[model samples]
Target: MPDISHDFVDECFEPSTARAASADRRMHTELAASLHHLAEAVQTTDGKLSDSLGDFASNINAGRFVRPSVFRHYFQLVTSLSSGDIDATKALISKMNATPPRNAHRTITHFGHPDADQISLELISDGMRLAPISDTLAQDFGTLLEAGFDLMQNALPELYGEITAIVHEILLGGAPHGDSVEFDGASHYQFWGLLILNPKHHNTPLEIVEVLAHEASHSLLFGLTVDEPLVLNPNEDLFASPLRQDLRPMDGIYHATYVSARMCWAMETLAASGHLSVTDHETALKAAQADRDNYKKGLSVIDAHGELSATGQRILDKTRAWMNRR
Candidate 1:
C-alpha cells in the first residue's frame, strides 16, 4: 500500500517556485485590470448604482459569474484610487456592506418530518433571493454539509485543517437544474478565499463530502498556483474531462484529476474507518473505486496532451505519485 501520511499530503500540496512566480504575475495583472474597471464604472455613475452596476450584480447572482469577492476588493481599491473623493465608490461600499449576510435566512428545522430531533439549517424566502432552494429543503442540505465536515474532521483531519485555513467563506446558492452540487473557487476567487456552493443536489453526507473535498482542493490549488501557470500549453487545446462529458482545457483536466485523487483519498479514509453505516461504507468504497478509475483516465490525458513547465511537472508528479501509490 502507498504511504498515506499527513507529510505526504503536505508534500503534494506545496506549490513550486515557478508556480508561485507565475501566480504572482497573473495576480498583479488581474488586480490592475480590476482596479481600472472599477474606476471606469465608478466614474460613470459618480459612485451611484448605474445600469452597469445593476447589470453586473444581476449577472453575478444569475450564475456563471466571476468572483463576487472581487467586487468587494475593488471597493477598497477604488476608495484608495479616488483618494476619498469618489462618493459613489463609498456608497457602493456601503451598499455592499448593507447587503444581506450569506446566512441571513438560516433557521432550524427538523431533519425529516414531524418527530425527528435532528435539526438542520433552513433558508426561507430571504434566501430565495440568492438561491431557489426553499427554507425547509435548505435545512436538510445544510445538515448534509455539516455531516460531511464532521466526517472530514474525523477521518481526514489534515484536509480539514487545510480547508479551514484556506477557505474563509462559504457562499450558498442555487445549483442549475440537474446538478446537485456546484463549486466556484477558481483563480478568480483566490483573492477572497471564498467557496460558492449550491447544496440542493446533495442527498447524502457522502455526496456532500465529495463536493466539499473536490471544491476545497481546487481552492487550495488556486492559492498554490496563483503565481504560476499549471501548464505552459495554450488553453486552446481541449481534452476530455473524466468528471464531465464536455471537453475541457488541460488546466481543467489537471484540476479534475487532482481533485479526483483527493476525493478517492477521502472516500478510502471513510471506507476504512468502519465508522459509517453499512450502506454508507459500501457507497464510499464504490465511490473511491470509481474516483480511482477517473484519476487514471485523467492521468492519461495529462501525459498525452499536457505541456507542464518544471514547476507544473513537479506538482503533477506529486499528484501522480499519490494516485499510483497503491
Candidate 2:
C-alpha cells in the first residue's frame, strides 16, 4: 500500500477478491500511521493519556481496527489531537468503545435501521431532507439484501466476497428518495464501512440489487482512497454527474462511471442466472441495459474531461475493458 508501486490498486481494478481483501487489510496501516502522529503529540502533555492510548493502540488487532465504529473513533481522535484539546482528547479516549466491533467481516449478514445512537453525529449536520423509511420498507430490505447477495454469490462470487471484505454494515436511513444527490444510497468518507441507503427509492428487488452494487462499489472506492485520491483534480473541479442532476467533482464523475458498470454486472448476472421469477428476470435485463446505457453516458464524459491519476487511469482502463468485453 505504501507507494503502491506494486500496483496493489489492481486488487480493485482487475477484480481479484483475494487482492481486494488484502487491500482492505493493508488499509489498517493508515490507523497505525494516524496513531504514530497522535502518540507523538500526546507523549509530553500527559503520561497517563499516552500510556492509555499506547495500550489501546497496541491492542488494536487486524480484526478490531476494521470496525466502522473504530474508524469513526480514529477520525475523532485525529480531530482532538489536531486541536491540541487535551480535555476533549481525554473525554474522547474515556468514551472509546473497546467492545468487539459490530462490523462483522462479511456482506449482507446484517441489515439495520439503526437508532440515533448508531448513527454518525455528522448526520444531523448534513441538513438533508430525510425521513425514516416505513416499517414495510425496513422489513423488505432484509429480504432484498438476502436475495440480492445470494445472486451475487452465485454469479459473481469474487465481487460478493470482495463486498464482505469491503462493507461491514448495511444501514437504511435518510431517504431523500430520488429527489437529489443521495437519492438511492450513499457511502460517506467519514463513516467508511457504512452504506446509508434510501429504502423508498428502490421500488423493486432488481432496483435493490443495483443499489447494493452501486453503493458498495462506492464504499470500495472510499477504501481505495484511504491513502490517496482516485483522481488528481480538486473537489472544486465540477463536472456533469451521470447519476445526479447537479455538477459534481471529477472524483464523483469518475466513480459514477465505474460503478455504473458494476451495477450492470450485478443485474446482468442475476438476469442470466435463471434464479429470478419471470417478472424479475425481465426487470433485471432492463436494469442491466439501463446501467450499460448510463455507463456509456458517463464514459463519454470521462473521455471528454477526466483528469485522472495513475491509479484512476488503471481503474478506468479495467472498467473500459470489462464493459467492452460484455
Candidate 3:
C-alpha cells in the first residue's frame, strides 16, 4: 500500500501518470483483498458455485476482471453472493466467465445499452433510467470524443495520460428524449474505471472534453476514497452543488470543487492550444471561466462547512496552492 497520503491528495489536484499508476496498483490490491474475502464467504455456501471461485481468482490475476461490467459483477458477488440464495451467484459467476478480457489498445469509448448479462446501477437517486443512443447519435458522440481526445493529447498530454489511465471505458448513455433530471456524467466507485455520460451535453469536442475531465476527476476521488472519506461531515447535511441542481453532501461538494478545478484546467489548456476553431475557442475560454468561478465557489463552501479530515485539509491546501500558482 502507498504509505504517503499526501501524494495521493496531490494527485487529485494535479494528476501525473506515475501518481495515477500508483493509485491503479493500490486500487487493484484492494480489489484482490475484497475478492479473497468474498471467496471465503462463498466457500461455506454452495460447493459448485464456490468451486468457480478459483477460476475467478485466476481470471482476475490474468486481468480479465478489469472490464467495468465484470468488475461490477465482483461488486454483486461481494454484496449478495453468499448472503442468502445461491442461484443469483451462479448466474453472476457465469456472466463474469462470459465477459471478454479487456482489449489492451482498443479505443476506450462506447455508446448504447450494456449487455443483457450486465448489471446496470439502479438510478433511484437520479429518477432517470439509461436508454440506448441511436446509431446516428452514437456515431456523432464517438467523433466528438475522439476529437476531444486529440485536443487533450496535444494540449495537456500529462493530464490526458492520467485521465486515460484512470478512465478505462467511457459509455455514453442517454435518458429518454425528455424525462426531467439530466446528468452530464457520472462515475461509480464500484465501477471504478467506467464513465457514464449523457450525449446531450456533448455537442462539441470542447464541451465533451470538459465532461471527460469532470467524470475522470470523480474516478480519481473514488480511488482515494476507497478506504475513507475526504471530509468528516455526514452526507445528511446537504449543501448546494456548483454543478448539480440539487443540494449535495459535503463530500459531494468537495468532489465538485476538485472536479471543477480539473475541468477548468482542461478547458484553459485546450483554449490556449491553437487547435480549436474560432467558435470552439471562444466557447472553451468561456467554459473555463465558468469552471474557475465554480471551483472557487465550491472551495469556499468546503472551507466553511466541509469539516474535512487532515488528509482532506492537505488536499484543500494543495488545491488552493495550485490555483494561486503564478
Backbone clash pairs in model 3 (N, Cα, C under 3 Å; residues 3+ apart or in different chains), count: 0
Give the per-residue lDDT of model 2 (tens digit) for 270-307. Answer: 77777788998888889889889989988888888888
In terms of TM-score, which candidate is stronger, 1 or 3? 3
Query: How would you encode candidate 1's per-residue C-alpha lDDT over 112-184 as one tens digit per residue?
Result: 3322111111222113223344556656666777887788778766767666555544555554456444533
> Could you give me the TM-score of model 2 versus the true structure?
0.86
Query: By descending lDDT, how would the candidates be arranged?
Result: 3, 2, 1
Per-model CA lDDT versus the true structure: 0.59, 0.69, 0.74
Write the number of the candidate with greater lDDT, choosing between 1 and 3: 3
Model 1 misplacement above 4 A:
1-10, 13-72, 75-131, 176-191
**Where does model 3 exceed 4 Å of error?**
1-12, 44-51, 62-65, 106-128, 277-279
lDDT against true structure, model 3:
0.74
User: Ranking under TM-score, best-scoring first?
Assistant: 3, 2, 1
Q: Which 10-residue span in candidate 1 carries the lowest summed lDDT? A: 116-125
lDDT-wise, the better of 1 and 2 is: 2
